[model samples]
Target: MGTSLLILGVALWAGAHFFKRLAPEKRAEIGEAGKGAVAIALLISIVLMVIGYRMAEPVWLWIAPFWMVHVNNLLLFIAFYLFAVSGLKTNLHRRIRHPQLSGFKAWAVGHLLVVGTVQGLILFGGLLAWAVVSVIVINRANRDWARPPEAPMWKEGVAVVGALFLMLVVGQIHGWIGPWPFGGA
Candidate 1:
């Protein structure tokens, strides 16, 4: 069940983004399709999250040390911070051209560390692998790409601070939205 949902989530997410490259014209014409794809991806992603979380109960498929969990938690925290900071008009995104992708990699790696099931490994670990590849591909492709306007210093400062602030709030309420079965409690 978890594997199925994970596959679906990956399909939806990958399919949605992958089409942009294959059918750029169609993608432009059917703006709604992109939105639809994203919406469906999000919905399926939620379902996948639920399944993964439910299966991630205290029961261990294999022995995982408590120290590993601590490390996983730290990685997850960094992942969240990366995701948040990438959203702002910061140097990260401009410099990398794919801050979100980088963040996704971090987030996936963090989760993979915590969850050792094959299904969990396939889902998060697979995504992390993809992110790494995509980052390299995008970087190579855009090595000579044109640059966008630079953001002001004030905006950069605000983005960094705002990212930190958002992390705090998200951490406080993480259990509510996080897929971890034990997150909220």
Candidate 2:
């Protein structure tokens, strides 16, 4: 049942996200209420995912080497930085077409490294696939790529600072939820 819920949640997350890109006509037919409906579905999906993952029993697959901890941390840091770049519209945005999804992929990979269970594989792998497909779907929908003007250098600096701040805050939340991310407390 837990596994089923997890699958449903992941599927809903992907479906809800894709609905806008895939079915613009139907979405428009719903008028403004469609946005609210999607938001509600996304929220329910998050709740389902959280409940499902916790309810699912662990089925460990592999034990990560101690060294992978460092790799995971590095990837998470890069993920955070990429998220900041997306929001800040830093110079990196000009090069990376989809910083947000790329960061999401990185985040999923980082979690996959640490979590070696079947549920982890399903959860992270599903999200990773969704992120990858989302990029493709979006790129197909919008062919013309108009790169935004690079933000000022100070914005990049702010992104760096924001990355650091985000890392600390998210790391704290991560630790609270599961293993301590800093040193595996």
Candidate 3:
């Protein structure tokens, strides 16, 4: 049941995301309404994924070494930094075309390194694939890439600090919900 829900969630999320790329005319037909529908679908899918992942039993495919946790933490830091930069008007944002998706890729890869369970593979691997495909499709859609206007450096600094705080909060939440990331393997 958990696996089923997970699969359904991934399918709904991916399908909704790819709908615009697959059928632009149809998407344009609905316009704002279509965007709302997609947003709702994404919300539902995320809820389902969270529930399914929590309920699913871990079936270990391979045991990750204790050292991998350190690597995962580093990757997660980079991922969060990228995610923060994506939302801000940073110089780095102008250079990195798809910072958010790239962050998602890093997040997925980091989790994959630490989590060797079937559910982890299904969730993270699926998201990794989606991010990769979305980046490719988005790049294709917007061929005329140009540099964005520069923003103040202080804003970027603030974003980085916020990202670090968020990472710490998330880590605490993860520990409360499941295995403590800083705990022994």
Q: Which candidate's lDDT is highest?
A: 2
Worst 10 residues of 2 by lDDT: 176-185
Write the residue-wise lDDT of candidate 3 on 39-113 in tens digits.
999999999898888788889999998899989888888899999888886889998988889888999999999
Root-mean-square deviation (CA) per prediction: 3.9, 1.0, 1.6
Q: What TM-score does structure 3 among the candidates reach? A: 0.92
My TM-score estimates for the predictions, one after another, are 0.71, 0.97, 0.92
Candidate 2, 1-185: lDDT as tens digits: 88889999999999999999999999999989999999999999988888889899999999888888889888988899999999989999999999999999999999899889988998999999999999999999899999989678898888888998999998899888978887756
- Report model 1's TM-score to 2 decimal places: 0.71
At residue 72, candidate 3 shows an lDDT of 89
- Rank by lDDT, descending? 2, 3, 1
lDDT of each: 0.64, 0.91, 0.89
**Residue-wise lDDT of candidate 1 within 12-54, one digit each (tens)?**
5566555665567888988876778767767777677567646
Candidate 2 residue pairs that clash: none
Question: Using TM-score as the measure, which candidate wins?
Answer: 2
After the best TM-score superposition of candidate 1, give how far the Cα of residue 76 lies from its true spot, in angstroms.
3.3
TM-score of candidate 2 versus the correct structure, residues matched by position: 0.97
The alpha-carbon root-mean-square deviation between model 3 and the true structure, to one decimal in Å, is 1.6
Which regions in candidate 3 have their CA more than 4 angstroms from the true location?
A: none
